[model samples]
Target: MQFIINGETVEVAADIRTSLLDLLRNYLGFTGTKKGCDQGACGACTVLVDGERINSCLALAVQYQHRNITTVEGLARNGSLHPLQQAFIDHDGFQCGYCTPGQLCSAIGMASEIERNIPSVVTKDLSATSVMLDETEFRERMSGNLCRCGAYNGIVEAISEATVPAAAAKTAGRASP
Candidate 1:
């Protein structure tokens, strides 16, 4: 099967039944996306499938053929860390760092959702094109990814900080010179 993983095109032979998580860690050797639970309950196996966060443990590798996959490894560009990665570091978003990769990927997808004005359960006005992401919105949206070390405070803080710049960039088009 062929896959575009982290901006690289690679082909590998694997069982059709193989889950994406297994294909990535076992076959392709990208171990950043953790395997907390084989089931989809835990978000440790989360990866962005065509820019949307999905639990890799629950998705078959064959199902993602020809689609873009963004693992934690792809977040950085030109040797510079993604804003969320830097925010995570600045806010101490991880304790053991096991869940950090999934958290970061999820945050990336979440930021995109916000930028597109997607509504969440906490969104007050559905008619509004853009919903401001406050603390409640962040917590509710991020409730899926679990952190056993209880780094919720830092995680929220980091995502909040990262989203501000993202929102600004979305509205302003580009950084001011």
Candidate 2:
């Protein structure tokens, strides 16, 4: 089957039952997307499919044929780290680093959701067109992804720093100043 991965189009031969995680890690050698629980309970196998995050371990490769897939390796550009990646390093958001990939991808996807004003369970004002990036929103959005090293504080800080600029800019545009 053909797949567009990290902006590259490639063809691979695999069984119909192969999970997207296995196809990416074992067949295509994109090992950055870790396989933690193999079950959907753990977000370690998270990856972006068309700018939305999904647990790759629970998705069949055939289902994603011809779809755009972004693994952790794709988060960088021109040899520079993605903003979230840099924030992760700057804030020491990881310890063992096994869950870093999923965290990064999930955070990015969460930012997109925020930009689109998609309300989460913690969002207090669902009718508001603009969503604020607050502690409650961040925690609820990132609850799917876990860090066994207990680096939650740093992870929250990094994601907040990386995503707050966009929210600030949007808010500033409506200011009276």
lDDT, residue 85, model 2: 95
Error of 2 at 17 (Å): 0.8
lDDT of 2 by residue, 114-175 (tens): 77888899887888878766666768888999899999888988987886565445543332
lDDT (10s digit) by residue, model 1, range 1-177 = 999999889999999999999999999999999999889886998899889999999999999988899999999999999988999999999999998999998888887887888888888779976766665677777888999999988888797788656753544332221
The stretch of ten residues in a row with the least summed lDDT in candidate 1 is: 168-177
Q: Evaluated with TM-score, which candidate comes out highest? A: 2
Checking candidate 2 for backbone clashes, the offending pairs are none
Q: Best candidate per lDDT, number?
A: 2
Instruction: Tell me the alpha-carbon RMSD of every candidate.
Output: 4.0, 3.3
TM-scores, all models, native as reference: 0.90, 0.93
